[model samples]
Target: MRNEIMRCFAVVFTVIMIVSGCSGREETKTAGGGGEEDTKPTYEFRLAETHAPDYPTTLADKHFAELVHERSDGRIKIDVFPSAALGEEAAAIEQVQLGAIDFVRTSAGPLAEFNKDYAVFSLPYLFDSDEHVWNFLLSEHGDQLLDSLESSKMLGLAYYSSGARSFYSSKPLAGLEDLQGQKIRIQQNAVNIDLMDALGASATPMAFGEVYSGLQTGVIDAAENNYPSYYSTGHYEVAPYFLLDGHQRIPEVLVISMTAWEKLSEEDQELIRTAAKDSIAFQREKWAEYEQLAEEEIRDAGVTVTEVADVSAWQKAVQPVLEKHGADYQDLLDAVEALRP
Candidate 1:
């Protein structure tokens, strides 16, 4: 009787061990295979843009973010703040430098404040046409300038077209002479200020957000920007005249904070770089379409749209501005000239 009882105990103990072993194996398999949450993003980043959500650059910013997220297999995520949610270009640039902001899409004009190489874009009449601008931007010289941002604790990812910035005002800009003595709002750049001064206008360094009220309240008689900005900001309502002088084809730059960039692995860095480059084609296409749309709609809105068939006189007026700033960037200017058609 005692032997039978011991045998029964041994068999029960064996059954318990077998069941526990099978349960442990199943848990191990589940852990090894991972689940939905395991594939989620490990890092999150932010990109800043002063343009509205519907603007070309902002759209491209979102596209770039999406590309990074997808290519990283959801290991990385980027959130874009458009319409100056984070801050204006200057403040955004400062934040990126400090790594408070991970990325920014801002005009090359503001970037000149950090690296002088970017000031080349701020030179009035520097690019003869849109093609001329891209020709230089895709060249070795432009790549050098992009790479040069590393010293500023920023990385230049890509460039998007801001188109040519032209002056528009409540007064008629029928000719270059009309710009004389006008109070024009411009970005806070010495070169831009000098360009306005050379054109015989007073340059008021103001944030972009204030331009509409400035024009309406008579604080500023004029402001310069591309067509999309003119219409999108509703500045055309206040400043009814549009000039197509096509001066200063300042391309907007996509930049990343070095602090944020270094945190990425080599594969991720390449992924981001390629994603940025890929986003450019889409942005450029949208930019061209929007430019035409803005021009057409603004004219329909009863805005006096004037084309400067003779930009020579306007270009000639800015000669002094070129000479003053051009001396520092002779090589870049030469490169730009070489790329001209």
Candidate 2:
């Protein structure tokens, strides 16, 4: 009876050990239950965007994330936080500078606050047309400007079109002459402030998210942005007068933190750069579509749309602004001028 009892105990102990070993193996298996080894991504990153999720920039951000994931063969993942979920552009950029945020799609306007070289894009009437802007942005000088961001601990991965900025006001603004003494909301940039001053308007530096309330509460008499922004933000509801002056054609820059970038292998870096460039086509196409739709929708909504048929007069008004700030960006200005017809 004692031998039989010992034999039973031995069998139970062996079975228990075998079961534990199998469970250990199961726990070590891939998340997909494909194999015995784990297959999680090597790196996971976050990208910040100040635009709404349905906005063109946000869509392009997702596209960029998808391409990176694909090109990296799932070894990498990029999660995009849009609509200022992370923070506003300025705060987000600071976070990125500190290496706390992996990436951000910020306006060149706010970006200039970090790297003054970016301020060139905010100069009013710098580009004759959208084509002129793109030509310069795609040229050798544009690449140099992008590379110069390294001084600020960031990298300019690519440029996405923000369209051209124009003024919209709570009160009627028939022409440049009407802008005198009007309190206008502008981006927080010295160049933009100077541009507003040169145009004879009181420059109220305000955040993008605050413009709607600013307009409604009369904190600002006018604000300037593109057609898509005016319509999408519903700024047209309160600011019924939309003047298509196209003052600034600042590009939205896709920037990555050098901290996060350094951790990536050269191959992955190249992959991300390519992915960002590839995403621009989609973003620009959507921008064009959205722009036209925005104009039409705002017009249908009874917003007065004024076209600057001859921007020469408006251009002449901003000459001092260019002359004052132009010295800092002479090389870039020369390059930009060379691109014009």
Write one digit per residue (lDDT tens) for candidate 2, span 140-241.
988888888899999999999988999999999889988999999988989988888888999998888899999999999999999998988899999999
The 10-residue segment with the lowest total lDDT in model 2: 21-30
> Which residue ranges in model 2 land beyond 4 Å of their true spot?
1-41
Model 2's number of clashes is: 0
Write candidate 1's Cα lDDT for 221-328 as tens digits.
Answer: 999999999999999999999888988899999999998888776877999999999999999999999989998899999998888888788878889999898999
**RMSD in Å for model 1:** 13.4
Clashes (N, CA, C under 3 Å) per candidate: 0, 0
Q: What's model 2's overall lDDT?
A: 0.88
